[model samples]
Target chain A: MNKFREGGWHILLLLICLVLLLPVVFMISNSFKTLQDSYHSMLQIIPLHPTFSNYTTLGRQIDLLRLIWNTFFMAAIVTLGKLITGLFAAYAFKYFSFKGKKWIYLIFVSTIFVPFTVIMIPNYLVISKINLLNTAPGVALPQMCDATGIMLFLKAMDKIPKSLIESLKIDGISSHMILKDIIIPILRPSIISIGAIFFINSWNEYVWPTLILKDKSSFTLPLALQNYISSEGGTNFPLAMALSTIMIIVPLFIYLIFQRYILNSISNSGLK
Target chain B: MNSSGSKNKFLTIAYLSPTAVILLVFMVIPILYTLYLSFFDWNLISPTKNFVGLENYTSIFTDSVNRKVLLNTIVYILLLLILNFIIPYFISLIVKFFINKMKNSYKIIFFIPSLFSLVVGAMLFSWIMNPISGPVAFLMRHFGVALPNWTNSSAMAIVMLCLITNWKVFGYNFVLLLTGLGSIPQNIIDATKIDSIPRWKMVRDIVLPLNKSIAFYVLILTIVQGLQYVFTPISVITQGGPYYGSSNIFYHTYLNAFVLYKTGNASALAVITFLVFLILLYLEMKFVEGRMGNCE
Candidate 1:
């Protein structure tokens, strides 16, 4: 029974994996084909005659470096900001018990339920009123304060043994010292996981940027790619395919960099 | 000592300040403004704000086109919820089997789509579904099958949208369930096997029950994500069209605010959606927190 089960499961897993991979495989294959070939053989898994013309045409069409830099910079800033803000808040809640801590945390967590749409008009108003619209900071600012990050960090911090805190206290360590020395080090994995999640969230964010940003020069990769497709540029299939391939590639690269942290957070959040 | 206590209080307040202020300024204030705007008959460009009480909400119900939009949203949500569960469960089951043999390297590979921005996902898919050169079309051609313009047909568009969303998100679920499965003890499986439980029964009776906590989270996440999906592809690829066939309340609400500048009506729609999500989230919390085992 065990041998049979193992064989059946492996076969099933491999088959599903293939189904999962086919679209991506097709994307890469078509990227190497001429526009005419790509369209005519749209479903082809193997390109009849591969070419790099798409990549060259794509390079001529958009400022690829600026788009990549803008996206990476925005994601990095948001990830860093969220980590600092969320960590400080979590640490304060965990180490220093104060009145209304529970209610305060509750209020923070409640914000998670509020769809970002509810605040769209107001946030836009604020941005425009401050004259920060179309700026990178405007795009990145809203992501800095995250209730989910705070809550996740708090949950992780709560799991730290009280013995560690007591031992540090006996040695005359201050709460700040404990936070810096003990808590931060212990929470490294959580930080990596949380930061990766934030980076992914910020990198792929679309609507807010679409609503707030106007200038084509400042458009992130996703927005730029969107413009490319909505225009459809019927004869520019190779350029479009090239841009599409690049857009997917950036995030895919990031995922490769942080897959373990992402997978960990994915499962842990599932448990919570 | 007094200073220290006061300082701690100050630090706590400081810690809470960023999230509180941002939520107030961005979320709470926007909602209030949306509420205020919804009460007024003002185009976003107009300097004048004329208050009209409940007219927008009333109009939404009375207008037949708007009614269709509401129905379309419901259909999209239902379809998305179904795809969300089935696709992720099957993917996670596959991942679960492979975990024993390979590292979750394969799981990570599969989950790569989740990391992509919706703009990227929609565009990539648009390219893939491009009738001329898209992968889906290519595959159909290989099978000697004629491919309908999947992304252009309103009904097919929504289903395709659901498929794209599921592809990106199921990996997130797969990873989560895999983690949940990983935490389950080998001894428990041994016990189940010794009890002569068939593999399917073992999964149903033991694994499913044990993993209900994570399952609950998956449901809540899918529901919320499904509801909000309007903005991603809608804003980027479809603009909720080939007509109004693909638009949901979320996108409709966005169009009201961003395009039509009907802040008042958009606010009303957002509030309505908010209430729906709240009710669904509450139901989920109750399901997870009530009589649920071990993950507690």
Candidate 2:
């Protein structure tokens, strides 16, 4: 009975894995086909004459290096900015007994529940009036501070023992030193977790970027890819798949490299 | 003026200033300003701003399209909750039970789609589901079946959009659920074994009850995020579709403001969306917070 149950579980697992992998496998296989092969009915599963021509075409179609760099720089800056601010706010909420802290934390948490649709118009107006429209900073600025990240960091910081803070106070170390030397060092895992999430969130953001950046030269990888995907006739499925294959793979590579930290962050999102 | 003490407060605020100020000015203020804007008729090109009290809100209540958008928003949220919640909850458990050594790897693979830009993910799926050359169509033909265009129908398009969104976020959900699963203490399972409880009873009486709080957290978070307006798929894949099948309240607001430049109508829609979000959030907090307390 035990062996049979185990075998049944393994088979089910294999089936689930296959379903999870199907689209990704199809994407890679389809990416190598010629545009003509993609349309042919008989040549569906496997490309009869696979070629690197679509990738070669993609290289020329978009400024791959510049777009990638723009996206990376934007995501990195926001991640770093969010980390600094989130840590400070977390420290304040966790340790400082400031008046109205409860209301402030409530507001902070409430901000996570608010939708961007409600604020997009006003935010766009504000961005335009500040003379930052169509600029990289405009695209990146509004998204820099995420309420969820601050809340996560705060909750994690709360878990640190009061004894630790008492020890720092006994040593006459200022809150600044406590945060920098003691708190931050202890919060390294949470920092990495938060950093991975912020990086990925900013990287994947599209709606705001589409609204803010109108110049083609300023388009990020995702925006540029969208334009490329739509500009062609629907028949260019192979090229679309090829570009998407690259887009999916780069992030997939990043997540794989830091899978542990990213998983830790996803878990953090739940506890708060 | 006390220099040293003031300096410490300044230092703390300074460290916290960049993030807090950005969120306040950009996120909080904009939302409030949007609420205010909904009360008036203001077009961007015109310098004239006319204040009309409660006109926009009243119009939202009466307008047919706005009414439909509201219904669509609710439906979208419900569909997405099922996709991101119920499906992933089971998937996470299945993955955990079967795949031990490569759990982390599976988590990473699942999260890959979500980490990519929304537009990119949407566009990829759009191609894969295209009626003529999409893989879905190809498979149908292989089995000698003709597949209808998935994104061409209003109802089916919304369903497909929900499915794609689910596929995109499932890995993240699975990871979260896995963490919750891992948090379940081993001694509890041992206790169940000692009691000679059946497998189903062990799950019902122990695992589910213990992890109910995290489950609620996941459910609330998924619904909130879903209602925020998934723009990528709407814009890239459906453009609100063959006849507005995929359009939700948020995307409808986006179209009004950006595409049509009807600032007044768009702000009205925005107001409605905000109210809906607040209502759902209040309910979730009220119920879930109380339930979480009981779990202890």
TM-score of each: 0.91, 0.91
Q: Give the CAPRI class of candidate 2.
A: medium
Considering only chain B, report the TM-score of model 2. Answer: 0.89
Q: Let me know the DockQ for model 1.
A: 0.52
Residue pairs in collision within model 2: none
Kindly provide the TM-score of model 2 when superposed on the true structure, using C-alpha atoms. Answer: 0.91
Which lDDT value does model 1 have at B159? 84
Alpha-carbon RMSD of each model: 3.1, 3.2
Residue by residue across B42-98, what tens digits does model 2's lDDT show?
775578878998898888779887777677777888888888898888767656543
